[model samples]
Target: MRSLTEEEIISHIPELSNVTLRKITKGYSFDLKYVTEWNGKNVLLRLYDLDLSERVQEKVEKMEAFKKLGVRCQDVYAFGEVPEENFCYTIFSFLEGEDGEAALANLTTEEQCAAGYEAGLDLNHMHELRIEASMKEHMAFIQEKFEKAVERYSRLDQQIPYGRKIIDYVRNNIRLIGESRLVFAHHDFHAGNLIISQKKYAGVIDFNRCGVNTAYSEFDKLELFSSRLSIAFSKGVIQGYFNNRVPELFWKIRSVHMAQLLIYHMNWVTDYFPKDLPQAKDAIQYVWEMYEGFHRTIPKWYEERQA
Candidate 1:
């Protein structure tokens, strides 16, 4: 899709008239985003293809829900579709700060952990907005995804190391899928999606990927992304999420989830995101070593830190 001009934006949202719009090109989402000053405050403008109107509406609702729950995220100022333009738009209060992934490396270990702790607390609040899916329905949804992942992995030309073992481990522990309680999740909560200001987590962004899922499943990105960036911060997220006394069952469920990711995510990246294949492989290896080839539930990073 062609980029939306500044005049077009103003024409669609008259409130943004006379403001300067600077295009933001830092994310993977297909939506066109721009930042500008509106009424003495920075605001974000996102334009989406008309076909994505429903999804855009869902994202806006989730953002509103998170705001009402006191989670640090974007606040919607306006949202609507421009039928003539064949696009939908949303205006949100812009979160100001450096991306957490880049900023964490410059922070002290304690600071990184503290930022992660705050992020975890915010995530806990988000989970309080429960979805109405039954346990049986949720389990079926997870199981179906797992089966599809397994089938996709089976078709891969080159599978990940310990692929069969990971598949077997997940299948053996399949009953754990029923133990999870479904809740609204950020779905892409990771250091990269976080905003850090002065060595602290300022807020989270990109709720476009939010959805209802098992609460423990929400930590998948921590294992796959955050830990690789800062183990201390990753540990802090788990610590704050569980109020510092980690549950044994959490470790068990997390292990199964990570195992499934080793099979499913690897195939996914290989197929659609080949550039991320190496990172995905590295994450798989890290998980295998951390869990001692699935012999343990708690990872060495969290265990050593506790010691």
Candidate 2:
């Protein structure tokens, strides 16, 4: 996670040779983000270890895929390794907007939901890139995760809210989860990674962790992160994705997916992010309340608003 020198970066990305280079603070990943003028416009230069060329190439292709699918994102201009450094860099069209998470807090309930809907529209477009993977493969991966959750559930020092019920729901509904379409998920599609310009979803950022997974799986992160910021936005995500016709089966499948994740959530937060544990715990409780003790399928916000 070391920062590259201005001279080293200039040598690699000549476009930034004369532009003002300023390091941008990062939240989670160790990847370095630099803000500078490219062609007289503010742009972001993201650099990461190029130890695995294939992985880096895959990410480049994924970012490009968004453009083909008509999803607005930090348009990637160039991606390749530097001449003398063991690092790869990507130059992006720095979006002009506020952090989507922060922007949601200032909006009215209706405004927040509209923003969520806009996100869903873009997300639906992003899912258009169909990845070729068998349902069996996804099922196997979920099965492996479920087995690990079961083992961890036994060893958890503190009980998750209604832990046993949620576990049972997962076990009972595991079969339904095996069948899903493979799509490239934003991986981190919550409020944190979105850009809100003038109360609208301007674009998405942080595709470093994007991967091919069941489309329904993307909602899990929203359930964990974005929903904590605003439930109106959370409900909008689902409704807008489905175009106001959310299916009965989607809710069932969503509940099952969330239940499985909740199994290991506490230990994961405490073990990995001890400082954020209290907030994470509160978020989990809010989730518990939202799902009505994991008894209801549709989250309360969406359900109560249903006509």
Which candidate tops TM-score? 1
Q: Return the lDDT, model 2, position 141.
A: 89
Candidate 1 segments whose C-alpha is farther than 4 A from its true place: 1-10, 305-307
| Alpha-carbon lDDT, every model | 0.85, 0.79
lDDT per residue as tens, model 2, 11-106? 777556766678888566767888888777888888888775567678778878878878888777777776467787888889988877779888
Residue-by-residue lDDT tens digits, candidate 1, 123-238: 88888885787878878887888899999889888787688888889989977967878887788888888899978889999887777788998898888788878888888888
Give the poorly placed runs of model 2, Cα more than 4 Å off: 1-3, 149-164, 304-307
TM-scores, one per candidate: 0.92, 0.89
- Candidate 2's TM-score reads 0.89
Give the clashing residue pairs of candidate 1, or none: none
